[model samples]
Target chain A: MKHRGCGKDLAKVSEFIDGGLPAAMCRRIRAHMDDCRPCRDFVASLRRAMALHRAQGRAPSPPPLAKAELRDALRSCTAALKKRKPR
Target chain B: MPESESALISRSREGDPAAFESLVRRYEDRIYRLAKNVCAGAPAEADDVYQETFLTAFKKLRTFRGGSGLGTWLYRIASNLCFMRLRSNKRRPFVAALDLPSGEGLRLPADSIPTPEQAAGKRELAEAVARALKLLPVDYRLVLTLRDVEGLSNEETAKVLKVSVAAVKSRLHRGRLFMRERLAALSEGAA
Candidate 1:
């Protein structure tokens, strides 16, 4: 895939996959990929990797005890702020 | 009807605890998840970032000005705290080794592409993803988490990170490549 323009085109593969490129640019990239084996493989692999992460969903949330602690802390902080307010 | 976010903010700024608490509840899970992703190796620090983000937001509510959305505001605060904690601990930013070996060996074999079900069932692969993510610099990790894991758009992620959309795209592309290389190696090893 080290062809003359392969590097330049591959650099845009991410944006290409994301549809961030202009329509004509996407067509050009697509045409380039049709003849480029490594670039095609790379794009496929990158897409799969992205899909894997997307499927992984959100990171684990704070634990229940931690959530409770945060709530309590916010409550106290807000209460103190309320008390300090001028009439 | 549920109270609008601006209304909630108005009450919150006036020292209304319930209103502030309502805002907190709306975003705590997301802020915590962001903290966890940004501070993957430091559970305690994640908690601190999560706690401090809301606390700091509360203290600074008057100055929020609504220039950005509230969620972006909270994300900015949390991200700053995460980076500050890393800096204080002398953890330098990770620069990806873009010069890593390429060619046939680095390509992901087609058969290894896991279906969603396969991906979900493969604990080792999930761990590989997590491990690879942890190896990325905080900037890349944060971008990947917000843009990929949390499903925020590139523009939204840029707003949170206070970078341009171009910067977000660059980071996300490089980060995804780094992760793909790591996962390819894992698949090869398992084969």
Candidate 2:
């Protein structure tokens, strides 16, 4: 994992990791990472993050505000309007 | 989707609580996800965003002049709520340091994040990824999550974010790179 690479180098590795690159470029990145410990580490990092995302998605649900609550609020508001009306 | 939601909105605007409830039921899951992703690892904040979004939408429904689709309008409200919450400088504990809620499967629990054990040894890894996402700016954050995680198509994502498809591609490209770099960093620590 003791390898060095730039953000440009990352562009190659990046596209490869995302499956966004063409076949030829993908082959090149694979060859590059195979020999480059640093790039290998970088790829590993990306995969690990993806693994975490796969695991920890959508945890809490919104507490139900309750239909009755919404209804009650609307009713109260309506009553307020009625009382304020000039008949 | 347009006709159905609009029909619901129309009924809701007519003061039908049931119709409005149907609209809420229809959009709640989506609205929640939009808030969570936009806030990026801050569920409590995300919760606030969600509450504000729905509340605002309810108040403003009468003003909807039928210009945009209803979901798009709801998305506009939810996104606005997220922006305010994120920009508030509240100093809440970063979600990176805490437990993400728990569960597995797409349906998801109402109040739990999927633990890695639930996902089998991948929980920490996922949290790291989410944290990296938090590091990204909001422009990137909104499009990336809405597109990749939520699986919206380029066109739909563009519509919600109100950007061009080309802009979506550009942002997503750059955002993915940012994420991959973060992923690279997190995995380095894991190893």
Candidate 3:
């Protein structure tokens, strides 16, 4: 039986990239990709977009002031912990 | 030199303030960034979430049973705080659902680091991406950011979001399609 058509495989491209499907399902998607040009292109572009987000959206390091604030906050937190009895 | 996370955890469990501070220093940037993305680029809200995450984590550190990695545990805390804050606050309205192509089959180049010129385009693309992402619901945005942008594995993402792996996969697929459609449009407009 045909597990899925190109339409179904198109939806599975991200899942394919993610290794979310079982091996047999993955093989069906690969077989579909071999025959379907549009699905392949969509997968490629989808990958490129994901790549762009990962490469460009690298969060800048937390600002120094924020670090200082965290330091102060943690200090106070630990101080509070010291005052309280351990659970 | 910094103490190892386990060593620090041990000390902190014994109520050592300095050791707890060490743990905070180790994870502050990462936790902050997760909060930033979960807040959909809202710095103020991200800041609040960051603060709340650490506060809760510290208080609850005694209960951490080492079943998951520290980062994952901390992220779970941050994720909850971000969603909590989002629920309480009014969010800016967002437009979702554009006519996206169902498929386009072509093998693109494999992953490569962007060069300087491509980097400029990437910055523009990042802005467009952020705009597109903001249009999605909070659950979709959170899954996309954690799995796609932040490179969390499906299991790790599921744990952090308190969803099952199947749920993470579903949200991730839909979210990626939503993003791809918008980013393609933005690229065509720029070209």
The all-Cα superposition gives candidate 1 an RMSD in Å to the true structure of 4.1
- Give the better candidate number (2 or 3) by lDDT: 3
- Give lDDT tens digits, candidate 1, residues B116-155: 7665546566566777777887888889888877778899
> What's model 2's overall lDDT?
0.62
Q: lDDT by residue for model 1 over A1-87, one digit each (tens)?
A: 245667788678778987889999999989988987777777887777777666543566778877788888888887787788787
B-chain TM-scores per prediction: 0.80, 0.76, 0.79
List model 3 lDDT by residue over A1-82, tens digit each. Answer: 1233456666677878878789999998888778766666667778877876666556777777777787788788767766
Clash pairs (backbone) in predicted model 1: none
By TM-score, the better pick of 2 and 3 is: 3
Name model 2 segments beyond 4 Å from true: A1-55, A64-87, B1-3, B88-122
Task: Score chain A of each prediction against the true chain A by TM-score and list the results.
Answer: 0.85, 0.58, 0.72
Docking class of 3: acceptable
Return the lDDT, model 3, position B43: 78
Q: Give lDDT for model 1.
A: 0.79
Model 2, span A10-48: residue lDDT tens: 644434665766888788777876886656655565454
TM-score on alpha carbons, each prediction: 0.85, 0.65, 0.82
Best by lDDT: 1
